[model samples]
Target chain A: MWSTIGEAGEFGLIARVTAQFPGTGDVILGPGDDAAIVTAPDNRVVATMDLLVEDRHFRRAWSSPEDVGRKAVAQNFADIAAMGARPTALLVGFAAPPDLPLSWADGLTEGLRAECARAGGAVVGGDTVAAETITVAITALGDLGGRPPVRRDGARPGDLIAVTGPLGLSGAGYALLEAGVLGPDDARRLVGDSAGGADPGWAACLREHRRPGPPYAEGPRAVRLGARAMLDVSDGLVQDLGHIARASGVAVDLDSAALVPDPALVEAAALLEQLGAARRAPVEHMLFGGEDHALAAAFPPGTDLPPQWRRIGTAAAPGPEGAVVTVDGAPARAGGWDHFG
Target chain B: MWSTIGEAGEFGLIARVTAQFPGTGDVILGPGDDAAIVTAPDNRVVATMDLLVEDRHFRRAWSSPEDVGRKAVAQNFADIAAMGARPTALLVGFAAPPDLPLSWADGLTEGLRAECARAGGAVVGGDTVAAETITVAITALGDLGGRPPVRRDGARPGDLIAVTGPLGLSGAGYALLEAGVLGPDDARRLVGDSAGGADPGWAACLREHRRPGPPYAEGPRAVRLGARAMLDVSDGLVQDLGHIARASGVAVDLDSAALVPDPALVEAAALLEQLGAARRAPVEHMLFGGEDHALAAAFPPGTDLPPQWRRIGTAAAPGPEGAVVTVDGAPARAGGWDHFG
Candidate 1:
């Protein structure tokens, strides 16, 4: 086949791409219309966007087109959950090389649909273009159910800092993969398995890295429980905690003694440490390596931390007027991942 | 400075990147928060997206980062406008090489902000990442004010076809630019000087290319006048007309002689043609060269075309039933731009 955009044509291309997606009822109008219509519950929508470029966000060596699609959907959905809203719909724009397999494109859409299905949402509309590499831009829309959005600035003095999901596994997994220590089975286990048992700690960590299982159900629950401030930890724990502290004009101190890796995770790290190649401090890794997609929040003093969440620290008024994050009574270093430095 | 992502940690990078952008009203919460809060007016938000990748959508030689940003914002906003909606905000995701200058990134944002201002919208949120090449994803939100959305499926047989803006200057300009025939002054005249044009037609056509001035005010008017089967002419006239025909299940025949090109455009194209150079067909070029952000719609017989729109054809039942897009009793060909073969 000749490589020319003239062959598929704009409308034909749109039709072909859109045909790959199944309809979700949230879409009042799907891809065919001039503009897709979506129902906005509460007459309001929370919107966010993320773009993942080929080889920048993920490598073909590490992820299939399906995994890329899943990651894109999961990350955006996590943003919505972080806002105490349930994701309802997504609009994705994809740019890919002309020579790229149509199957790969279809797989990406399938992965997006699958992830959205898991989150109770659907694809509404999108645009596609011929490009040098794949670029995915996803706009996630969520419904707040009339609840005032929980913000990062509401933490108060004496508030307990907690997280609903395990942390530090994604970074460790990536490190291991990059270091080439893991074989096919081990790599698959590290990247795909989410159960808490294969070294419950390591499994949890690795899964956290792959597709963060944001505690979507817990966001509204935390809000209803009068959570003073909250945010899903997309970045590392200590760093995100620092965000809460700065925004709330407070200080946070973590009790490292109370922090312990799950035995399985410990064993995995110990093995790596035994190999004399581990750059990760198990506790430090969990605290500072982000992408866990965990829910971290501030609750008023004495409020019980739910079964899914673990209390890690307490907030106090900014000491000497500046916020601080102290680990084990000392100044904690290393905040988390930044997109630009 | 460190050469790779390995230097400044991802978390630190994000902090430094986002630190420069101060919070605005729509951002009730800012970047450091788990998620930012944005108010949706009337509980409705119109959203659309587009992705542009280097070499595919642009070349470093042809466009500056700022130009890319403006064009990205402009095209996405035009889609919202086609829906008879007012743009409210935008979210942009960018991926580029870490070695790329911060000045270029900042310049791109400046361009985005500037273009959004033209449409009464603001950039609300975004994500940035390191990549092999620059890729931009822009998502635009709009408000429809409770009106029934103007759609592309409403045109009926016997309706008159009209366009709100000029056609084909972008393709013409691009042809010249790609041929290396444009002097600096000619280039500016083609892609710059968006406003204050004494030549409305040339200005309209060039504006259609660089930053399409979608008929913002005319959208609501068209909806109110019972305009049916509306769309933006992203592809050339004949091609887009075909879409109207297919979607409305009707045929459209144009009177080519009725098209009056602006004198300046005619002069320019004539000069190129006389030199046996330009491969672009002046008339055929307008018929198929796209990127003109003009509005097209079908109206009931005898209905007055709006002040800004020009009546171009009439809708009839599809087929020798009528030529789907006949120009002077002949079948039209080469309708418009195609994305993929």
Candidate 2:
């Protein structure tokens, strides 16, 4: 099923995909119009966007069409939830070679549909184009129901830090697939078991990597409970917490011993290393590798951790003026990924 | 001037360009957030999108970076207005080569700024990445103030067709440019004048091709004045009107003699052919050429033309089976750009 870039062209593909999704009343006008008309419950709309280019963001070899589609939607939905907003609608712009199979295209749409259904959002509209490689640009819109947006710049000294999901699973999964140690069937089986929670803790981590389960309800919950500040851990825990610390003019200290997901990852680490498959930096990888898509927040002391959240650290007044994030009392070196660098 | 794509990585470039724009109040969230938060009046947001690739949409040799940027914004904005909506915000995704110049990037941003200012919208967010060539995907959001979207399917039989601005000048200007008949100064001078006017209209046509005046306000005006069906004339009048005929289940009869912009296009057409240019097909050119960005609508007969509109044709009930568009009582040929055959 090889297809060239010129066959389908952009507009034809868009019309085809747009026809598949049934419209809700909120979408007064869908894909064919100049713009889609979506009614918000009140007057506030939360909009977030992400772009994924072939080879750079995902390789066709590692991810199936369905996985790529699901990952794109899941990551974006995480951003909205991190804002304490409910996902509402999505507008996608896809660029692919004209010769790509209609089945591949259809599979991508189905992937989006599955994820949107999980998050309670709808794919309202999108644009498609003929290009040399595949690219997906997604803009996710959400509603806050009129709540003040929880910002990263509001954490204060004496606030407790917490996270709502596991970490380092995606990076680990990528490592396994890249090393040829895991075939598609094996990868799927592992990921599925993790999702189905046969090994509750590691399953949580694997699921965290493949398709993140954003703490959707926890966003507003944090806002209602007076969270001092917040952000999603797309870029590993220490690096992301550093963002809050720097933004708030404070210092963050994480007690890694208390992180329950760490031990589960240790087992995978040992297994891989025993097979001579582990990279040199296992702990560093878990601490700095990103795409976890978990929520991290700072709250006043004594505030109860929501049912989904786990206390990870504490925010303290600026330590030596410039220090931001410290693990085990020392400023951790090597922040997260820098696309420009 | 040349900047490697790696040097101007995605986030860095987005940060740089975003810093150049002024923020509006309704923008609750700006570039750095997961997505922007915009105030959607009437609780509904209107969104339209357009994709322009390097060779297909614009040739680097034919148009400046500024011109390309302007065209991108103009086309997308026209779609917003065709929906009878007021423009609000834009989200852009840009993919370009690593070796492209920083100056070219900056110039393109300037063009986007200029068009956004003209349309009364702001560039709210965007994504940037490396690609074999430049590709821009823009999503424009608009507000309709609770008005029903004027759709192409709404035109009833017996409606009079009207146009809000001049047409066919863009094709004429393109033909002139291709022939190299005019010097740079004269060509620049003829950029924005209309064809039927005393001026050469080359400048107007050229401007129309590069950055069209969409008559954004007229969309709402037409809807308010009882327009049954409306669309912007990206393709030429004869062809675009045919779209309405097909979509609305009616036949359109256009009075060719009444096309006021025809005379203004003659001198340029003659000059090109005289300069050893091949004899171009006039109807073929006018019927299929696009990018004018003029607004077209259908209204009941005797209905007052909105102040911005001029009478062009009339619609008749569908004849036995297939709807048709006739120019001077003859069947009009199907003419317009099609991405896929």
Candidate 3:
């Protein structure tokens, strides 16, 4: 068995990794070529890319190789989903030290294959190289299915801003992990509280942080239902909403009362406070927590929101104070998640 | 004025870099969204990705930020071209240290924009992240113009192998650069020879090493001309030909007499020898040296080659031994590239 990537060498490792993937419906050509061809039936390809650098984006001490690979693909696919497209292809560029275990690479490939299949995409093509640190760069391509691309600048004044999917579990999960409530072991070993392992809510946060499940199908649904502007909440809700507001040239005001955290998510916050890791309240996490990959969009005024979506805010004329996004009529500070910050 | 990447922050850097890119034809949407939509007129998108890691794939001490950026993009676009496609969109995932100069980042963006324009592609969307070393991960999308992709496995026994574009200049150039003959000072200071700078041949080698100009158009032309198998000469000629030979399940025989090096390229090898940097003959450079980004293809027997392509080899039944690619009736060793090796 190949022990390290150095022992397997580049071509050998590539052949082993790519052979595991089963081609999906949209793939006209798969790996082992100069490039792979994927069907973009709407005459357009929706594309986005994201990077996960070791120690900076994820630490081996915290997440498994599978978690890293899945997270890298999941986040980028969420962008395609936000564009009202269905994921079709994934191209990954992986750089790691030669000393990295071959088993680790296999796990990463398995994770990429599983996630791409789950999102209805195929692993198209990738390049592997040696680097000082492990870096996973993923580009996800999607087909818009003939619908016009849903954009952030489409929101208009008097539009109802709605959200779909869980919002703060990832953030709460991160806190739990950082607080040592969940560590190298699974959630079963909650320090000094083994019974807490039964809490599906707490476990969900941990799972979401490792691999977020975005509402991919809901993106196209929103577009079909006449939704105007949309984006995935990869960054905090406030910061991401600020993007829509600025792009749409409007002010967004959130109804904090309408923003209800899942009772289990609130329980996660309570648990974080129990471990003295709660820097913000549970509602704050719902408002500002990021990486939930939740779809947030603006529908025409009075358009019936899908049962899967919750109307959490409204778009209006720009406020005089220069704040594009506000909560309960007050300008809300958008914090968390800045690579350079 | 902005100095380092940290001072500009992630969003500001993204905005600054993206602003330099003028929109191209195939782009349905540009940056500043979750994802960008690109036209894929044939309903198929040719996709490929490559990574350039600092020190591993490029050295800042030797290559300017612009050179690194151009090389990263050129290599990936070459892959697209090899698929018989025209490059349409480019998505970059850049991870760099916080202390990296913002001007360097700007220069990199300028280079990416310049190359993408030359290839007729638009800068779609990308992510910037913080990492210890600079890594440029590029995913290129291309349109096949309704042509079936020219694959490596299509070659048959009796197919004539042909090559287009200059070969081994990059390898010769790399030797010159590594030998202290062409360092710090652009070709202006050629170590012990000042007059050598006036020689365009030597300068071409240096320039080609920094930014390869693959004959991208020739790829589609080869397809149009009924090429059965084709690939870009990224690794050495022997190494890359081995890919086609193995994939097509045929033994390949090269006619070294047909692979006459460019007079100028041969001059570069002589200059490297003059500087005591020549590790092999000029012809050997063409044989085992790589990174020329030239197109090599297998055409049907009795087919006249386009003026751009020169017949250099022939596909034959597999020999008794395991060697798939041979030179002058003898097994040729395939070396030069293996990230792990």
Candidate 4:
């Protein structure tokens, strides 16, 4: 077994991590330099950053190091996808306690590389340091491929609202995890079992919570098909839609019956109820729970929708109460993850 | 007085910080979106990231929030400059306790904007989250301006080693701050005073420790002047030079007598001696102290060196011992900051 990070030292640990990520053709220079050089190709780049801190953004008791790393990269890459851009590279800055096990770090590097490969990008550079707690910060860069970036403010009053991925599964998983119905250790065990022995639906939610599978390819598809406005569903569907509402100066109305929760979420909720956990309706989770990484976009009225996207709502002119989001002709509470609050 | 971050909430604090940074021309799309879009005119970008954790990379008791912010941006920007690129934009990820004072966050934003301006860039976007401790991670992007990057492996046997910017001031300052010779409060007071007032040398060291001013323009200048290889002296002069020597497969020999210590560092050393602090010679500090953010490059021998670059050494064929760097005809110990150790 390898020693702790303190015993392994910085350079040795860096070497171990870098060896896990092979250089891609897009990277002119990779790790071990003062900086990495990457091709932008389209003469413009889209960039975003996200921070994940232990206990605040994640709990070690609930999440494995690999899960944490995947979530960190997935969230940042989702931002790039939301802009209708294809991700090019990622730069990561990581800090953790000196006494942390080397296996934890290696697992994290593996997770990072796996997610970047799924997102069609590479980890170009990174920095590592020792701190009191584990913190992972990722900055993702994307190429627009000569197309104008799809922005939230481009939505118009008559646009159609749609999403390209499943909703509320991550939130349902969180509720299950919080209730102790499914622990992280159990999820890890299920990962190796091709067919989850007893409850596949619950197992699916657990996997989604650990590593979200965003529809990265759907972003460019939406752009090529003329997406008018776009954003990612990170802080709940209602709360995230509110941003588009305010930015585009329009009201968004979702048809409650049109909004269908994933079948896995329904199964997970049923299992939680059977386990004597407090039952949160799947629809409630869809409205208020976050971290789905689903790409939401507004298309021009009468535009042909992509097969991956499902219509959930429509945009309208703002009412006297100002630009807002509503469900089934009633105002939905704007509640979601609030970092400071 | 304004309340803490918890009282202000994440969006409110974000609004305050974003208001401090007006969008620059390079930023096609600024904050409040899923991601930001910046023009990358050169079709390529140089990228790097760095993490600053409270108490490990900085201490609230020893450095102000503004200083911490400036240092974070400056160091990452220095990495881009060391690659012979001109910085164009920055994406920052900040995490802190919810109860942290809003004033501290605001001061940090101001500092970030100030440093980006100095480096000829803009804070295009960022993410803010709550955590147990303060952690600032910055990813900087730069344009190569149609020039090839000066990498670490490009030096030849007959190259002259040179440096652009002051050396060891930050290390001496670290010594003073560690010794409590100049507290954060005293350093703040000295910022407004132009005269020596009680101890100017200690004050200079404190400033350098808080914020570094690397020769950003000199990096591109060196590339234009046909420099063979380059990097920033981040982890002490000797330790950083070893990286170049190892990469280029050559032995670098430094002339110790040619190295000059800054007058402020000499004065700081004398003051520490008077105060009975452990006596570390100024020359020793110059050779071993780190975090100066100075540019070190190798130029073709007999090249007309720029006035900003001072000759320090020469590159030669690898020695029989397989050692890479030596000083004054003897091996120089490679010692510098090691975060994990």
Candidate 5:
């Protein structure tokens, strides 16, 4: 095997990168063709795309290739799931430097394969090109199972808002990494035998940040349970909820107690505090942090919810203040992740 | 309006860029949500993705933002077309530096809109992020209209190889730009009016390079006409034909006469020669140059071809040489576009 992609060459590297990728199941035509065909059993395709740029979305110094690969797929699948669909296939567009290690590509492929397997999908096709930096672009396709898509504009006044998974864990993990409390893969590189012992909470936070596992099935389950509005909490719960508010022409209010920080995030907050780094309350991360990839939805009042989905907020008729997110019936600081900003 | 993306911010920029984009066609759910749903109609989705990186795939100094946008969509659409499918939706992932002008993004959006209109599709949804360089990733979803996908592994012995449109003009145009002849927009900036007078042939070549108009309809037509195997003539006709040859277990031999250079390419070749650049014949460009994105396919011998398709070669049962592309019954040079190589 060649050490570098430049050495392996395009065709050779492509063959190597895609050799053992699973092709059975939903894929009618996989890689090595002009295009890939995936079954759209409902005669509709729920598709979403995401881009992971090195240094912007991820840093190689912090994340392993596998982690980035998993993240790329996870982000896109979250979008598909948010639409109440089950993912079927992913088409990747990878651009990396020629001198990039072939091993990294292999690890990335493994991560993509593992994630696709986890989501009941396959990596059907991809294009590879040489560039100065690594850019992973993924397109995830899903099927809605003959149901009307749950759109963001469906949230009605008096609907209860619930989250399908933990919120702000990735952001907390990111805060830890930014302050040198690295993830398991590079924890030693950042802090050589840090002053504290190994912490499972910290590890969990790191894992969540590096390889988030969105509740893919819960999306369809929520739809079947008659949830109205749903979205992936990528740009913070407060900010993303604002999207539902605006789209549905309603005002959203979060219950402070329901938005309590997780134990892992509390520990992450404590670590940052001890490090004398910039600090914020654990709930602040939940409020304004991003990249959690958790699904948040608005369900009709009196709807029975699964134990896994935590009721966090409620939608109400918009007041004179128009559509926005508030806490405890009061306006909360409005902030969200914006790449350009 | 804000001048730079950084000034406009993510929300403002997204609103501005996507405000005027058309969305009433095959898209079931367009932007303003986590995912876009496109109608598949026949329970199958023909999907393809492609990436364009600044400086590698295009030069801003040569290609306008509009040109890059057109190229990005064209490449992915060609893949869908090659699969005998009609594109329905496109999801874009755009990453650029904060310093980029908002007007550039506007121009890019216009180009995306124009091309999507041409292909009978809509720009459904996209993810925008900040990066050090510009990268545009596009995923095109297509409907097959209840037809079986035309694959690259179906060419039988004695099948005639044909091309759906002109080839090598993009490569020739690339040669012109690389040698300072430049496209219409950048030509004045590069050559300083020293090239005697404006040339229509060179302009056509530049258009091919900057904004290749792949005869998309021809792809589904080929499939309907009973094409045995087909592929997009990206990375050169010879190199791409090898895909079908290898996949179908056939040797492909080109009719040198049938592979005549287009007049536009001949002019480009002459210009490149006069500039003392690395010289290549127009036929050489036809044989080895790439990025034309025209469709190439194998059909049963004596199958009547439409006027648009030119019979270029023949597929035969593999000899000792295994699967390969030969010219004039002799082994031809096997050079083509390779990103790493």
Candidate 6:
């Protein structure tokens, strides 16, 4: 029963949002000041920014405000994790229509706080303004914890390529959403039916589509274990591996057998089949789906990977055509989501 | 002729934009990586963010792509400066339609780089995405250099209130622009007429309206000289001072005679009069106009002000109504631009 943003006023809405996120951890100066002061401790700070635009990046019809907010924070924080840095703080710039409900704004703030908490960071500062469309721009700051950042250009020949979290689940979820098997109304109902364990696979994919749970801690762990190069699987695994390949002046060959689908994805495939979807191999989704947010890294050959890490590929000297990424010794097609494509 | 973003493709447009901003200064890792790494020599970083939406915060007809980019960086950096810090790096999140001209994006990047150089910072990282409207969200990170941040809550009774940059000029320029006496076409011509010094007053006002030159270095200087409290005059002199007064639990009394307008504003008034506009005191503009980005600070009583700083008022114990700011012994109205207002 909250009033709209126009009725609550900008300052009033800001106060309400700030109250929800009291300063925590190394934040010397939090919101309500000119700028937030964050303790970097190591004399270096890792920073990344991302912009999510309505309809282009997300649809209000499909995502609740909370889902939108969580996704915004998650993706940006994933970039920081990709650098093998522990996220410390975030600054959000949100713009939406004046007539939007204040409850929606509150939901968005709660979602942001929840995601930042999961990433071991806090929402230190932000700005909100009125605009015709909803736009969320987030800047995530991270602490390297006295470690050198794991850059994409540092991989060498004979490195082992690995992944720390699930891939292709988000892509499968997106496919289900796009096929209208689980519409917005059904998705909202499913969100409330936590105890109704019916169709767990469908629910898991839908949840992944709405809010990704990136393995944030594994990033710094990989760096600590001497990861030569690393990045997040935001664009598909093949596309992002191609980036590391190009940056490191090497070629990567991913083993198709090693790119195994998780149990949830296997269930999601069955659900899609029951829902009359065309029998496309779920392995295709595993290879090309975007927004997985899994940490992909290259470590020295014969290095012991942590239990959570799974070997998926190997890096080698480039072939005749400069740097390339292949699947089972064949050059893989570079297909991934591009904003302007 | 440059192709549109859709035709050029996202990666091509990004390459074009990134080429304009080469990394400089304390940037350990610049753009095109997973994230940018910046040195925070003092072990702390001052961070602030701002969002500018097309038509809501600015008009494409009025601001060139370059002006828009510069203004976006300038305003966010000014917030860091207001905290008594030297800006070190910037992260930009830009969202525009797919059909936006690639040349415009390149011009925006060039403008951002120029302004960041002025503020002694570099555009270390950024993200560009497709959206329905053009939106620029900039996050500025700053170094405090082992000095304490001059916060808005530190003002005390008997402190001298001062400003380090011109006030109301941007406001006066906005008035002229709104009245159509200085239309966008004329303003563009004025920008190009660098050597044509005729009507210097009109040209100055127009220039200030397009791009404000805030006293960035003076912020840390004020802190070194023991500024009691500080903030930027972004939301009008009276309104912003009121924020300081409320935060410090004190009252501020301004001498109206000391709130002097520059000669250009006086000339602008005459021009508006000749244009048959409603006759109003230009002082109102000085007290209420927004987006100036001038620094306002409170110093100890009887302190010798620096050459650039001008004392205009004194802080005192709060009046019966608690914290307040008055002009010429009259309580000033708290009227300023609010996004939702």
Instruction: For each candidate, give the TM-score of chain B.
Output: 0.83, 0.89, 0.95, 0.94, 0.95, 0.93
Root-mean-square deviation of Cα positions for candidate 1 versus the true structure, in angstroms: 4.8
Most accurate candidate by lDDT:
5
Q: Which stretches of candidate 1 lie over 4 Å from their true place?
A: A1-17, A181-205, B1-32, B184-208, B279-281, B321-323
lDDT of each: 0.70, 0.73, 0.86, 0.85, 0.86, 0.85
Stretches of candidate 6 above 4 Å error? Answer: A183-197, A273-279, B183-200
Which of candidates 1 and 4 reaches a greater lDDT? 4
Query: Fraction of native contacts in model 4?
Result: 0.94
- Model 2 misses residue B225 by how many Å? 1.9
Best by DockQ: 3
lDDT tens per residue, model 5, A1-341: 58998898877877876775767578887888888889999988998888888888888878898998888889999999999999899988889999998899888988998888788888888888898878899999899998778999999999999997878788888888888777543454544455245555667778899999998999899999898999999988898999999999999999999987888888778767866678888899898888899999999999999898999999999998999899998888977777887
Tell me the chain A TM-score of model 6: 0.93
User: Candidate 2's fnat?
Assistant: 0.51
**Candidate 6 residue-wise lDDT at B4:** 84
Location of the lowest summed lDDT over 10 successive residues in candidate 1 chain B: B195-204
Runs of candidate 2 with Cα error greater than 4 angstroms are: A1-12, A182-210, A262-264, A275-283, A321-323, B1-5, B173-203, B262-264, B275-285
Local error of candidate 2 at A73, Å? 1.2
Output per-candidate TM-scores for chain A, rounded to 2 decimals.
Answer: 0.87, 0.88, 0.95, 0.94, 0.95, 0.93
> Which 10 consecutive positions of candidate 5 chain A have the poorest summed lDDT?
A187-196
Candidate 1 residues A118-180, lDDT tens each?
888878787888777778888888878888788878999989888786666766666655655
> Between 2 and 4, whose lDDT is larger?
4
For all predictions, the C-alpha RMSD in Å is 4.8, 4.4, 2.2, 3.4, 2.5, 3.3
Once fitted onto the true fold, the runs of candidate 3 whose alpha carbons sit more than 4 angstroms away are A183-191, A194-200, B183-200
lDDT per residue, candidate 2, B226-266, as tens digits? 88889988867777887788889998888776565555456
- In model 2, how large is the Cα lDDT of residue A113? 82
| Pairs of colliding residues, candidate 6 | none
- Could you tell me the TM-score of candidate 3? 0.96
Give per-residue lDDT, candidate 2, residue A46.
76
Model 3, A121: alpha-carbon shift in Å? 1.0
What is the C-alpha lDDT profile of model 3 across B163-255, one tens digit per residue?
988887888888877876454354445544532545556667778888988888998999988999999998899999999998989889999
**Candidate 1 per-residue lDDT over residues B148-205, each given as its tens digit:** 7777777888898888876767666566556553334553454454322344333334
